[model samples]
Structure formats: C-alpha cells, structure tokens
Target chain A: MALRRQVCFALYAASRATTALYRPLLDELGLTYPQYLVLLVLWERDGRTVKELGEELRLDSGTLSPLLKRMEAAGLVERQRTAGDERVVEVRLTAAGTELQARARSVPAALVAATGLDRKTLVELRDTLTTFASTMDIAAQELAAKKK
Target chain B: MALRRQVCFALYAASRATTALYRPLLDELGLTYPQYLVLLVLWERDGRTVKELGEELRLDSGTLSPLLKRMEAAGLVERQRTAGDERVVEVRLTAAGTELQARARSVPAALVAATGLDRKTLVELRDTLTTFASTMDIAAQELAAKKK
Candidate 1:
C-alpha cells in the first residue's frame, strides 16, 4: 500500500486499539472513551462552556449534546445555562466527576506501560500526531469554505 | 495535560481528523472511510474470507458483517459462502469495485497534500502507529485474560 494510505489506516487502527484497551478500564468507571475525554478536559480545568469543550475535543454540539446529556444522567457532569448568557451552557464536573480523576490517573499510566515504548518515543509520537491533526483540520476547514 | 494522557488523545484526534479529511473525497465516491478501507484490502488481493478481512482490518465480525452487507447492497462487492466451507464467507470485488480503484487512487494523493508532511515523516509515523496498535492489542488481551 502507498504510504499515504497506510498513514491513515495506521492512525485509525491505533486509535481504535487504544480505545479497546481502555474499554474494560473505563467500564469499571462507568464511562466510555469519549466520556472519559470530556472528564480529562474538565479535570484539567473545570466549568467550561459547551463551545469551549467542543473546541478542545473537536466535537460539535450535535455530537457533544447527547454525550453531555448522558454524562449528566450518569451524574459525572452537570450542565447549567449561564444567568449572564442564557445561550451559553457551562459544563462542570460533579463531585463524583472530580473524585473520579484520582482513579482515572491510573488509566494513562496503564496505557503507557501497555505501549512498552519509552517516554521520549511516545512524546515524539504524540507531538507529531497533534501537529498532523491540526494541519488536517485546517485543510478540512479550507475545503469546507471552498464548498460554500 | 501529562504526556500519557495527551498521547491517547492525540491518536484519537488525529484519527478523526484524518477521517474528516477523507469525508468529502469518499463522499464523492459514495464510500464511507471504513468501507473504502475494506475495498483497499480487497483490491490488494480479492476473494478474502470474512475472517481474513477481519484480521487485516482488526475489526470484529459484528462490525464487518454489516459493513460488507452495505457494500454488497451497493454492488461494490459480492459475498458468497464457500462451497467447501459454508461458514466461511468470501468477499470478492465486483466489476464496479475493481473499477473504483482507479478513481480511489486520487484519495491518498489528496490526503498527502492536505497533511503537508514530507513522505518520509508520514511513513515513519505510520510504522510507529502500526506497532503501537499491535502492542496495545496484546496488552488488552493480556488484561482480559487476567480478569478471567
């Protein structure tokens, strides 16, 4: 296969593999991979608006809305419309959500050990992928603009 | 975020970004990204059994069965239960499926340009991710075995 084709498939397969590895771990926490991601962002800095969270996660409201609703139902997060701006809904981690972070810390640790790659190698891989994703996102935006 | 947390998110985001970039291109071809991947494997060597395709793609039967059914409905491929082993369903590219390969060649070219990364860097990244995914898969299996 061409390098370009292999690159995309590699990323796709790796992402799914990572998620599959996390499945059992997250299941015990009653969270899915995406839900865990939302918590990761919240754990970093809580009380983010829906738009902010969407921007960080590269997820639109159409996808985030239902996900947030489910998270709220699970009692991990609470969404409240701002009094100052009714249109803006802020998502805050619940007490349970905040408490879950301590346990969630082990997930990444387990994953790192699972990869068996040295810290430096993993960091380089992460940085490269981050830059790649950003470049692709820009290209996608330009393509969408051209379609308009 | 710690490097550990960021690594998984990086892969997750990059995979989605890659898929998003392919969305428009594949849409024109009336193929979803996963479906295109299935065709890629078939084009390489047609008449692969469902099990073989699943192994190559790292997809389970639950996922591949429906996907193959959709592709069959679209006349892109045909699936037949082998006479020698009725349980083994072999997937072969149809005339349309084989012809689509010509047009599909442009996809990787477009993606390469979109990413703006040098071919060498992309190739290295692909190789690393493929290995990373394989390692994680083994870890997941080990974890599952421990649970049992």
Candidate 2:
C-alpha cells in the first residue's frame, strides 16, 4: 500500500523496525529493549529518580516500576529511598549494570549496520527526529494545559 | 546526556511522542493508536489476510492476533475464513469501522499541527523514515538468513 504519506505511520513502523533490530542483539546481553533504554539513561547519569527515568523513557510509573523490579532481580539496577526523603525512590545501576556498558558499547554500531545506513546519515535522521519529538511534546503539553 | 547521538533513542522517543499526541484524539474515537494504524491499512484495501496485516504493521501474530480480536469485538472490523481456504482468515472493516474513516480524516492534520512542523518538512521526515525502515528490514532479513 502507498500509505507512506502518513507521517505517524512512518514513525511507528520505523520505530518498530528499530526495536526488532535491537531485539536479538540485546537478548544476548540479557536485556530487553526497554531495559537497554533504561540502562542508556543511567549510563549517562548514575542515579536518577524513578520519576526522572520515567520522563526520559516517556514511560509511566506503572510500566517503569515493574521494569526496574525486573532489572533489580537481574542484578542490573537497585531502587532505594532517598536519604533526605523516604518517599522519593531513586534508581541506580549496580556494578554489574555499569559493566554492561562495555558489552553495550557495540550496540549502537550494530544497530547502525542493521539499518544499512552510514553513520553520518543516521546521525542527521536522529537529530531531526529528536527535534520533532521535542516540538510534539511542547504541543501536547500546551494542549493538556488548555484542557486543564 | 550526549545520548542524542543514539539513533535508536531518537526514533524511539519520536515515535512515543507521536503516539502520545494521538492518544487523546484516538481515545475520543474509542481506538488506540495501533488500532488506528490497522484501520489505515484496511481503508487503503478493504480485506487482507492476517499475515498481510501483520507484515504491513511489522507486528508478530502474537501481537496482531489479539489486536484484531479486540478490534472485531469493538465492531470496527470482522474476521472470517476465506471460502476457498478455511485456514486463511481475512479481515474486513465493518460499517462502523468504515464510517470511522471520515471522522479520522482530521487526525493526520491534527497530528501535523501537534508536531508544529510544516507539512513539507514532515513529509520529508516521513519519507526518510520509510526508507530507513525498509533498509533496516532488508538488513535484518539478510542477517537472519546468514544465521540460518
């Protein structure tokens, strides 16, 4: 079908393809795709609140909590209450989790190869998507505020 | 984080953003974002095999089967075994599903507005994503074949 004109479908399809490509590679690392993403966020910064991880992943606590629990069970991450406020739960990577970064170092390159695109071209596409996502987020926020 | 360099994250985040923007509009229509995608495919061609639908959406039977079941229950679509082949199920949009198309006409425009990008720019982005996804699919198939 010539449904290529639908921007949303393009994004959705491409996104799924990306995840599929990552699946086998990540399965070897004992990480699901979402878990890999959570690690990506944590690798960049060691300790983040569950709320912050949720924001980065655009996943609600309902989804993120169980994922963190699984990662904790796998010895990848640990979630504990903050010293200053027991109510605040912070998610941190364990030594094992941190070490996964070394294994994961090749993931991006493997993903790029899977796309059959040069790194330069993929970089440009990534930046464009990132900007579009940010713009979409702003519009969604404005719409929500208006509804409130 | 310098994670913007990660192409997968950009696509993942942007795809989520697009889905989030579609969520409220789709909720009003009693459809989820993925259901809307299914309709788009059917609207282009009235009936298709479950396998075809799975391919078009890049979803596995495990996922597509249950989704079609839910859509059938919602009266948006119907699935029946083809007369020539009892084993092959074909999905066709119900009258309600067909009518939903007119209502869904505005969805693309609303999504474009949400992205806050000119239609031309978004079109460029869509084409880029479609090509990238196709390339990735080919690469994946080759890798799978090699592994076999």
- In terms of lDDT, the best-performing candidate is 1
Docking band of candidate 2: medium
Estimate every model's Cα lDDT from 0 to 1.
Answer: 0.91, 0.88
Q: Residues B1-148, candidate 2, lDDT per residue (tens digit)? A: 3465788888999998888989999999999998988999999999999999888888888999999999999999999999999999999999999999999888887877777788788778888999988987887787788889
Query: Distance from true position, residue A138, model 2, in Å?
Result: 1.0
lDDT of 1 by residue, A19-69 (tens): 999999999899999999999889889999999988988999999999999
Off by over 4 Å in 1: A2-5, B1-5
Please give, as one word, the docking class of candidate 1: medium
Per-residue CA lDDT of candidate 1, range B1-148, in tens?
A: 5433479999999999999999999999999999999998888899999999888888999999999999999999999999998899999999999999999988888999999999999889988998999999999999989999
DockQ of each: 0.70, 0.69
